[model samples]
Structure formats: structure tokens, C-alpha cells
Target: MRVINFAHGDMMVWGMYLAWLLATRLGIDPYLGFVGCAAALFVVGLVVQRGLVDRIVDAPHEMQILLMLGVALVLENGALLAFGPEPQRVRSALTLSTFWLGPLFVDVARLVTFAVAVALSLALYLFLFGTDLGRTIRAAADNAYGALVIGADVRRVYAVAFGIGAACVGAAGALVSPFLPFQPSAGLAASVTSFNIVIIGGMGSLLGAFVGGLLVSVAESLGAVFLAPSLKELVSFSLLILILLFRPAGLFGRRAG
Candidate 1:
């Protein structure tokens, strides 16, 4: 499903809102409520893929980009209307709990978030490499025509791929909701950050994306510690520029044949 989802961050914002809703209205913790968010976004992905993306699957790249941009706009505005412009943060007991490790205090919320992220990444890796559906998805991504030749339902594969991607985003939103304050306008920043991570890691490579995210996070942390906190983003952008110049294919992405 080689689709560039410009709406990814907006979808994540929706997931945050959903988790917030559950927590405030239903008393479900964001940690456990993330499952519901993921499931809901999975359906959203299916609807967007089938209703909008499928209509222009073969269109030019410009059309695809515009379509996604349009989707992003819609999601952002919808969120603003529904959630208002106030930044929201989910309150969690885990976020308040902390433990001392040596001389430093460790945040339980951050630790849990890291563990969940790693687990999800591993699960995604296993699914892609070990399951038939995952393999089919990879094949379709590599060559849609070849997949179709082998009697695969390429459209369905695309739908599932998109759904899974959205689910991942939703889960991520819920996971970070405990600490990150978010609003509709935050989606743009999140989208940019995501692009920086993907580009630094290597597009089309899950390992690259995972490593890239870690690298970016580490770099930002170092930047904030060594320089100014406000300059952290500058460091990330500088790294992105270097990667683009030296390894345009990305750290793990294959070079174009």
C-alpha cells in the first residue's frame, strides 16, 4: 500500500480524543482504552482507503498527495469542531508515579510507553515476516500487478494495510496521551516529526522507521541537554538534511534500481 498518508497525524489526534473521551466519560484508562482507539481507527482507515484512495489508485503522484492533504484538512477541521482548540492531556496514575533509579528519577509513564512501543514494533515485525497475510501485503506493496497475477486480492490487501497503519497511529496516540498535550493544530507538527523520522530511518523499512524514531528521540534529548530545549527540533531537521544529502535512500531503504 505505498500510499503516503498525510492524514496520519490527524488520525492520531482523533485517537487521542477518543482515548480522552473514554477516560473522562467512561473511566477507561488510556493504557487499556488504546485497544478501542486502534480498532476504531482501523475502521477509519478502511473507510478512507475504500471511499477516497481507491478512487485514484492509479492517478498521478500529485493527485494522491492532494487527496491525502485534503483528507488531512478534513480531519483537522473535524477535530477542531468536535474537540475545540484547547490542548488536552489525559490524566493517568502511571504518569504521576515515579521511581528512583540510582540518583535519577525514572518516570513510570515513559517507561511503560517505551515498553509498549517496543512490543508493538516487534509484533508488527513478526506479523509481517511470519504470517501469510503479511507476506501478501509485502508482495502487493512490491508489485501490485504480480500479486494480482497470483490471484491475490490486491485491493483488499491495500485496505488491510491501510487499516493496520491507522491502527498503529491510533495506538501511538493513546500511548502518548498521558504525557503529550495535544490539539488539532498539533497534527501538523506531529506530521512533520513523523516525516523526519521516516526519512531519517528509511522509507518502506519498518526496521529503519523504528531505529529512526529512536535515533531522533535520542538526538532531541541530547540536543535539549547540550544546547537549548527549543533547538531540539533544529537538530532533528539538521539530521534530516544530512540524511537526505548523504543517503537519500535512507539508512535502511534500498537504493533505486
Candidate 2:
């Protein structure tokens, strides 16, 4: 995923933040917040893809980056205007009540988060691999020109894929909303996390994204437990550097986009 998708870290953090905020402030459950946010994000993604990214599907990669940057700016500023500049948090009932499992401390929230992430990943895989529309999406992703020649609705596919990706971030936000502090600018960190996962896992591969998330989460957990809890970012980036040095193609992939 890392080899293909750029900036996954950002996505994870942003989504998680949204989930955290919605649940804590509105008296809703985290999972409920996740569902609502994902749904909302799906709509937002549809609009962004249909209204913006769709227009530049044929644009050069560098141009696409520029376009995304512009959109990021708008979203960030919009958050600033609407949510203000302070860090915000939602109430999640999860606590440090850990179970001593024969020498390791396990937090229930972490376990739950992992479980939820896995379930969501499975759903994403099914959506991508289980139906006719999924095949068209894959085809369009592979080659827009060929897809267009074959009568594939490339634009529609683009919209759906982008929508799915954005909605994933939203679900992420709503899931861990109860456990952290967030601000509009938190998206920057989320972007960084997603970018790391994508690079470490491989690009354009959902399986890569899933593994990247697990690997990075494990690494982060280990770092927090053994090293300075403050060194989470430092540790994560160090692992990323090692992975890139030894297997530049990514943990589960070869080839790049």
C-alpha cells in the first residue's frame, strides 16, 4: 500500500479524530459515531471525487498532488472556522484497566480497536472483490484508457473508490474518538500515519494497507511500552526507514505507481 498509496498516516489520524470527537461530545457510542462519520465521509468523498478529483483523473501525478493539497487546505480551514483552534476530545468509557496476562498488560480498548479495524478491513475487501462493480473498479484502476475503450465507466469508478477511501478515514475517526484529543489540524498527523502504512505495505493494494496498519500499530504499541512513550513517531519512522532500506518495494509488494 505504501508503494502505491501516498499519505495513509494522515488518513488514519484524521478519521480517528473525527470519531473521537463525535462520540465524546454528542453522547453517542464510538461505533455509532464511526458509522455516522463513515456515511458522512462517503457523501463527502462522492462530492470531492465527482466535483473535483474526477475532473483531473487524467492529470499528471504531480498535478494531482497539487490538487489534493488545495483540497486539504480547504478542509483544514473549514475545520478551523467551524471547530476553532483548540484541541478537542470526546468521552469514551475506555480506561487503563488492564488485565495482567502472565507478564503482559493488555488494554481492552486496544483489543477492541484492533478487532474493529480487522472487521472494517474485511468489509472493504469484500466490497472491492465481491461484485460486478468491483471488477469494473479494478479495471478502471488498472488502466483508464483501456477501461474507457472497453466501455467501463471510469469516472464513476473513480468516484466510488475515492469515496470508499475517504469514508474509511471517517470511520477511523469515529472509532477511537473516545480515547484521544483532536483538533482540525490533526489531519496532518493522520496523513503522515497513512503515508507510512501505504509505503510500508505497498501501493494500490488494500491487503497491503491492512497489513501496514497492523504492523505499524504493533510497532507503535511496542515503542510506547518499551521506549519513551513520547518517541512513538520517532520509532515508527525508524521502522519505516529500515523497511525501505531492506525492501523498498514494501512488505507485501513489488512495483510502484
Candidate 3:
């Protein structure tokens, strides 16, 4: 999830950055560019599921891996052709400014990202706990066969839930785009981060995702201040290794095969 977040932001934001830069350099308001990129990727994510994910659901894990690797190949090469083989960054709204918050100083952009992440997490929690659809989703994720036996339309649930996960990263992408520079092939790194978050939080637990995202964010934040910024990735997964070594069931996840 973290990696996906990074890739989404890189493409969405990096793409937006380039578009805005080229246009503004030629004299245009970058807000228009930002909106255009955001809308485009929202549509792309929606289409990605409709086109790609739909075909991969029942495939073996290895097949899924092959499909994703192929998709990455096409996407990266296509981007290189379209956007060129250079990395680029924009003047981010997420500057290195600190805000005093009742005894803690916070990075403004990080703070906003955390706030948005938390709100989304809360919304997801309420969806699972408070809504019928959310209940169905949980049931389906917990046991697809049982859900189907209970007449819950398991396939549709899978489609919708996968769509939601993908879309979550899409929205995150838009939010992060104005904050980071991006390269065409950055999704690989983003995918790593997403996997780290998923592993740390415990799979199949929404609340874990919330807490896990926050923990990763805080760790990365503190790590960069005291250690090398480049080591954040190692810090994240190393912590994950230690946690899983002891907990195995994730910090909050139920144990399952």
C-alpha cells in the first residue's frame, strides 16, 4: 500500500508537475494542470480495475505476479516514451515548513497527509462497522466461500473492494502529487512501500491499515531526522520484520493460514 501510494503520487503528481511546468513555462496557471492530471488518474485507476484486475482475480498467485510484472513493463516503457526517461519534480505545496501543534512540531505536508489518511481510515472503519455494504465486504474478505454461500455475490464484492483499494491509492496519489517529484518508473518503489505498510498493519484488517500507516509515517519521519533519509525504507521493513517475528499475526490481525 505504501509503495502504491508512492507510485500513485509519483505518476499523478510527477505527471502533473511536468504538465504544469511545461504549460506554466509557456504561461499558464498550474492549478488547471493539477486538476487535469488528477482526473486523468482517477479515471485510469477505475479503468485499470475494469480492464486488468477483472481478468486476474481467479488466477494463481504466480500468474498474478506475471500479469503485474507485464503491466509494469508496459506502463514503464509507455511512460518513458510519453514522458521521456528523465526524473522531474515540481515546486511542492508540501514544503519543509514546521507547524507548532500543542507541544509538537509537525511538517505541514506530512501533517496534512496524516490527517487525510486518518480521515480515510475512519471513514473505512465506519463503512465496515456502520454500513451493510461494509459488513458484506468484511464477510467476503474473511471468507469468500461463506459469503457466496450466504448469497452475498462474492465476485461483485471482490470487484468493488479491489476497486476501492485501488481507488484509495488513486486519491492518495492526487494528494501527494503536489508534494513530491516523480519519475516514470517510480511505481516499483511505491509498490514496495505499499507492501511494507500492508505487512506491518496485518493483512485483512482496516483498522490495522490506519494504525500501520500512522506508525510507518512516524517512523519514517523520525528516522529521516536522525538517520539517513535513504534508510527510511530499510527502517520500515526492518521494523516490520521484528514485529512479524514476534507477533506473526500482525499487531492486530487474527491468525490465519
**Whole-model lDDT values for every prediction:** 0.91, 0.72, 0.63
Top model number, TM-score? 1
Per-residue CA lDDT of candidate 3, range 69-150, in tens? 6666676667677777776654444546678989998777656655766676678689878998889988887777789889
The full ranking of all candidates by TM-score, starting with the best, is 1, 2, 3
> Per-residue lDDT for 100-140 in model 2, tens only?
88998887766776688789999888877898888788777
What's the C-alpha lDDT at position 88 in model 2?
71
Model 3, global lDDT: 0.63
Q: Which stretches of candidate 3 lie over 4 Å from their true place?
A: 1-46, 90-107
Stretches of candidate 2 exceeding 4 Å from the true structure: 1-26, 93-104
Q: How many backbone clashes does candidate 3 have?
A: 9
